[model samples]
Target: MGIGDAQVSAEDLETVTQQLGRTPRGTRAIASRCPSGHPNVVQTDPRLPDGTPFPTLYYLTCPKLNSLVSTLESGGLMKEQTERLATDEELAAAYLRAHESYLAERDAIESLGTQVTAGGMPGRVKCLHVHVAHALAKGPGVNPMGDEALALLKAQELWPAGDCAETAAG
Candidate 1:
């Protein structure tokens, strides 16, 4: 469809074309309006051009709504894009990976020192610090890796230190 057609709304054409294209690569091109006038998008997947499987449905603001959606999609793509939420299995797997890594590092540090205190091994501590910082820095958005990292950090009580904590806090 062309950009301009009084009978066809740009939003409708965009939605239908996206369904046919089977690619939701870009942000939603439509917005939703509630009874109270709250704008949002109700994502629905009709089918692909070849009738293949599609991703889950989700509502989002239109990219035309001041380019917010486009900005988010672009930023996410640049930063190893992630969804807003994680499944339980994903969360569990991330937690297990982080926990295993932390344990292995802790063991290595303990081996280096005859007596291991809370601050005995600065190397392992530093690693933990970095890991936690990385997780938290992923933003307040819901994510499996971030959640797992945060959980591991809290379990170990390896609070942030020095510039890392300052950066995370800021």
Candidate 2:
């Protein structure tokens, strides 16, 4: 995802803290917001302030989104997507590009010196959360599988609506 302005206010941090139920570390900016104007995807620093490596550059922080993704996982969407990847040459190429793009974005902040990208990218579909976060933050067309999952969510009428993230703050 594009980093955008990379601005994180104290209020924004507070909202994220509430959403995650913990202090967020190395939060670079709010990469994407839900339609209700709350952060859903956050752009994070590749490495934590304490020098611990954090490979996840874009984090999905909305509790509702998390719950929906978890449900999707339990429904075996990952396996379906992975199976499609094996046979869909166009999709496989896009997924590989997504992997490379993820690595490049993280490297721009700080080189982790590892090819490992989130959500079992490049060859496998592992975590819908990562892919969803990527698609949400970066928008459609960047990650093929992510786009597919998002389309599924839309079809199921499960796309997060309302200020669910703000509700966590309450």
Candidate 3:
């Protein structure tokens, strides 16, 4: 879509409504879409309609992808990443870059006043869902931990490769 078309579309809103099972709050645009043309990642406003601070910039909406990431989280992937972050200086440095990038993206719209990025970035690893969403939205090489989690999911065949998006009629 072009810059003008970047604004949320009716189709995108409907798809996100279905993906979230409720009207999404603070949704600005569809950040990424599934193979079936359904919204998987969304770009949300820094603040909600009620003027509440919403730090999660990119939200993951696809149920299939959410389930896969949840499985990875339950399997101790987050703990593994946390451990890796403590031991691997290069990886930690890369994660710091990811944190900076996330802050830059969010502050471009509105400053959140703290370098603390979503999904426990910079010094720690938490919430694979958020990390995965960031990776999916920003693409690979942006978040090393997220990229690693996605790679693990793909190796386990848990990543969504086919179109599993739910249709309106379904």
Candidate 4:
């Protein structure tokens, strides 16, 4: 019932399973939560029990948030973000750091034997879900793209236009 804690409560596990519509694998910790205490982001192991390499260290587990993020992705946000990476040197550098940070975190758990980080990081914005999950898990100022995506979503209980946040929290 805590961030970075090894023990994940059965309730949280069950909630995540319901959110994903499948039994989750490699879940390690509850990375972040909605205002109502629902687990919105989960920290996972580098590899699954079946020996599958799962590079996603932070997994978004809220169905409502997932739907919103999917909406953003469908809106061609990924393409625009990727294009911005080519010109926004500062953003690109920060994204590379985010990628490195993700790799380090995953490596600390178990090396997947590849530097391939999640979310198409350091190069392109392939997945808004991953970036948003990363931002929620690590907090602000860590992932620039994530922060931007979060802003675009206006996803925070403190924000005025928190459609996703309200959906997840409520």
Candidate 5:
């Protein structure tokens, strides 16, 4: 894939491609990097190369992070989050703001003409991977669910806050 104005180095794209096990489509930039200086997340275009209205703005690229998030999902984290959305008014409001922000950012590039945000934002927690990617890309406080997921990862000490990302890449 052509680097273009993706604002990412060729090496970064190469590493991301390897991590994803396939070429990325419409990658606009390296959205986030780990402490080891590897691309942990990427900012993808609203529309993919095939004209697909891709809503996932922040795509997590780290293999370790992906696996950790997958484990969290299998543990019924989404169910817990969804339940919270029904009872927690403050959290639900914050999540709605996060969804609006995500849509603004993506629509600034190209309008998707739909209100559908990634990771089931503004309602439920569908994918922790997308939440984590969003949190890592936009930083904490942007997505409460994403921040909570990262905290869980940190508690388990499975999050790659060091050379683990580099090691996984190589």
Candidate 6:
């Protein structure tokens, strides 16, 4: 199927949740953190006291080539193919790019940190680095684009240990 045509299904989401040992509610909760360590559940589009948007982790779920790769790798479809698919180089590169973008966004937010707020709550935004890492560490059920997205998310944070590369290599 063409890249854009692939879709992430409910089954895929269930698989990811099972693999990660996390519930959807937990995932959403993690996404709502502010820099000051306050949870943003009470505020819609909450900002930090310094005027930064609550740090958010975004994930675009879909089925695509990477999902195929993950399936093949999980099933031991081919030695050569698995080796190429499981390597760290490509993932590392993606992680770096994502990290750069996150840093830039953080800097921009910091510049406007004094103006962010929602209703009466003080803004406390911070980048959601771990969520991105989790996305990057997606296993066999996740599609290729999803994998790339995850890698970008992880790379943004200097390749955090215990996920993505670690799981893939293991």
lDDT of each: 0.33, 0.87, 0.83, 0.84, 0.87, 0.33
Put down candidate 1 lDDT per residue, 79-162, tens digits, no spaces. Answer: 331231223455445544544443443344233222222211211221222232223323233223434444543465442323
| CA lDDT for candidate 5 | 0.87
**Every model's TM-score:** 0.24, 0.92, 0.91, 0.89, 0.91, 0.24
Question: How many times do residue backbones clash in model 5?
Answer: 0
**On residues 35-60, what C-alpha lDDT tens digit does candidate 6 reach at each position?**
22222111112244445455433332
Alpha-carbon RMSD, each predicted model: 19.5, 2.6, 2.5, 3.0, 3.3, 15.9
Off by over 4 Å in 3: 1-5, 162-170
Better of 3 and 6 by lDDT: 3
Model 6 alpha-carbon miss at residue 136, Å: 13
In candidate 6, where is summed lDDT lowest over 10 consecutive residues? 118-127
> TM-score: which candidate is best?
2
Give the per-residue lDDT digits (tens) of candidate 2, residues 54-167.
999889998988998999999999999899888999989999999999999889889999999899998888999999999988999998877888898888887865455245
Which order, best to worst by lDDT? 5, 2, 4, 3, 6, 1
Stretches of candidate 6 exceeding 4 Å from the true structure: 1-47, 50-87, 111-170
Give the Cα-based TM-score of candidate 2 against the true structure.
Answer: 0.92
Clashes of each: 1, 0, 0, 0, 0, 18
Query: CA lDDT of 4 in candidate 6?
Result: 23
In angstroms, the error of model 6 at 43 is: 12
